[model samples]
Target: MFYEASDNDHKHGSFSEVRQDLVSGDWVVIATGRAKRPHDFLQEGKKAFRQPKRTCPFENLHENALLSLSLGAERGKNIKPWVKVVVNKFPAFQRGVCSIFHKTGPYQWTDGVGQHEVVITRDHERSLGQMADLEAELAVRAYQERYRAIKQDECVRYISIFHNHGRGSGATLSHPHSQIIGIPVIPSDIARSIRGSAVYYEEHKECVHCVMLKFEKNDKKRLIYENDHFLVFAPFASRLAFEIRIYPKNHVSHFEDASEAEIVSVANALRVSLGKIFKGLNNPDYNFFLHTSPIDKLNSFRHYHWHFEILPKTSIWAGFEIGTGIEISTITPENAAEFLRNIKV
Candidate 1:
């Protein structure tokens, strides 16, 4: 049986309803009531775009250092003393006792045991989009080096590397930087995705993301950038305007498995796509995070695709959105892809 709203009960205003995928239990917003006008998305909700260069902490590199890569390596020119991979002085997590699971009064908590480090570039004003491909590649290399070093710790369950740009996306400072958070618990979102992929593998003997990559690579409907090792596209079920994801074409479980050459290629893909979004959307604040197969599962999740999720801060959560935990995307992924496709990086 099917149902439709009749004219008597129908009202006129663009709104959105989120629909859940039956098989995967993932939510996708059905934009039946797309209320946003063109200019509505351009405004930054919480992003404090500009900062005083004089007070910028990164400009004077006397802070602590997790690891540093020189400018001559990637920037192509040694303009004074330049380095990447500066340790955040105010780190979220520091060297504590190993993450010992503890039982509180009727509650359980584990030590926030792990590492929190920032991957910062030399130039204070230049964002990743303004950097050379080699520079971007070096940033990725540092991520790899750090991940390898941190994962050996017994208390660490997962290491999440992510970047938040502008205040709207939760960057307290205006500096261009990325962060790595190593935690003892597997993130809830990643767990859900892993379960979904596992169920899909059991039922169909194939990974759902691989299926999507194959389809997107063939159709080119949502694709924004493609290289030998990676592909970036607006997801079929995008969470926000101009939301893009970068995926490895190969079925690699761990991002750390990526070779130096593959890392460079992935860097090019990331930089170019980010450049498109940065240019096309007029420097929208965004966040990018890496989701890879868990280290606990050995030789498993080989079917899963490792990827990066880039979510631009284009919209805010309303009551409906907050209550339901579903994002309403006004602009269709197709249209968003079209907008980015025209932008030359």
Candidate 2:
């Protein structure tokens, strides 16, 4: 279950209170501490960083590709592939033993052992928001293929597939690219989400995300877009303004397990959703990432639901948010969803 404070829930003109996330159990403050209308978050006049093609590292064809996919007749050409996956030139984690914990003066530590690969789209200027449905599907397919390959590594405990859109969102290069990182340890945030799902399942005998999806689809207040196989919506307990999530209509535990049809549907949903944000909010910077079950114990997390979360850089964390470990969203999810729903993409 999720808890949110409606405008009427306020007493003595106080607008803010903490809302707990159903999956991660993290708290967020909604329209209380700081409040703004949805339009106020528009990123008009914000300049996006652009690197010249001559200087951009990803502008040329990539060699030593781990996986590559191409369209129709272009499959065998010497040109670049539609989508390509290559190891990161500078990886945060490297190929090494799954290090055991060692004591270091009362502290425990291990080597940062894992694999990191970059998934690059052929077009340097076209972001996912600007891509055609088929183009986006190819990118999603690349992620799935690379994920399947990386999960074969016994040392990998979790894999993260994420895209950073603009300078503010941490994209060093202007080229459109996503990253897949396989790590030996599960992220703390993901661990909490998994544990929460397990506890909820043990208590209710159903997936927490499935329950949320049912409610969101029926309520329709927080929903942005939906296709036959996927549903995109603004999360009720949004961590940031215009926070969006895309969930498969049917329960799925791992992203790698998604079928081709599901991938196509999700690709369309993602393209439309991101396009809406691009037009509605004046092309703001954003980051989107996949949240799925760990590779090591897939069956143990069947109660979990895999999904994609998109967080636009609408607000910066201040002292209160950083200190309390709770985010503050200036605009409510309902208003955010309503604004984006009417945007023509």
Candidate 3:
């Protein structure tokens, strides 16, 4: 196994290092170079922020309570709508007559076989960074509940749940909301992840993610915050600097089956992580999304691990970035984490 210094890896302190990932065979530069001490990561005395309730669209969300959550209540609130799920006014994949597939030319496409829902909270402003733990938990529950329902569909092969915060983060409106797009075809990224894990599992008879978790746990430099069930950490080679990842300790394949308690734990970490970013960088925009096993072949994904990725909008990709998939991060993740770690929550 490729290894680095558990203690001497980050001499600049704040737990900085570049660790390699096993499954994708990609090296992640998980530098905590600029990271602040753990005690420095909390948000302190600041102006009590509010988005003027008069303009808040989510105040009376009952007007749009399309789906009931696992509990009696609806999903999301006005406080942390940034991370919650809301029904999309214009759904990309709307549900119609559920029919089978058909072949057209050499290409075969199914009857838009899935559901699309938006996870909206009761707020026009105040992102997950400013939300309460309960509010964030409520958002995660909505995702799980919706996933459970969507996966039951015979035609759905994959589901994507993602959040976009701030105008730069692709928020059409200043509202906080997440989107669930259930489609018949598994995403290319998901396929690659599954393929990588499958190949590794066949050769080693081990879950690569699990092995990474073990190493990360042992070396806590990259670890941000970990709860009873989940872990939040920065990757070694973050595509975008300060990229954060949340993973469940249990190697579960499907996010649809996540328990209520698990959701609470995840939402807590997710919110805190965002809050750290907000305070650290003075309200920077960010995007976060979930990656889980596909519903079509759920069992085959046992080798896979579900995780959430949070990418802050520190810089925009120009023409060169758009043309090529390769991203150039001006600020190293180690420095970004240093900036975030010092934030007071």
TM-score of 2: 0.92
- Best-first order by lDDT: 2, 1, 3
Q: In each prediction, how many residue pairs overlap at the backbone (N, C-alpha, C within less than 3 A)?
A: 3, 2, 27
Over 200-300, each residue of candidate 1 has an lDDT whose tens digit, in order, gives 88899977888888888887777888899888888876777788889888777788898777898888988998888777677888899999876674676
Off by over 4 Å in 1: 1-24, 32-40, 43-48, 71-83
Question: What value of lDDT does candidate 1 attain over all alpha carbons?
Answer: 0.77
State the number of backbone clashes in model 3. 27
Model 3 CA deviation exceeding 4 Å by range = 1-21, 25-64, 68-87, 98-108
Q: Estimate TM-scores for all models.
A: 0.88, 0.92, 0.79
Per residue, candidate 3 scores C-alpha lDDT tens digits across 1-345 of: 655456446554445444445666554333355544433423344332345666666655544565644333435643222333455667777676666667888887667757788887654666777877877776788788788887777667889999887666777656677889988788887888889889989999998788778877777666777789998777655777668988989888778767777888898889889998887766667899998888755376888888899997765777866775545554455455555655668
TM-score of 3: 0.79
Residue 111 deviation, candidate 3, in Å? 3.9
Q: TM-score-based ranking, best first? A: 2, 1, 3
Off by over 4 Å in 2: 1-14, 32-34, 73-81
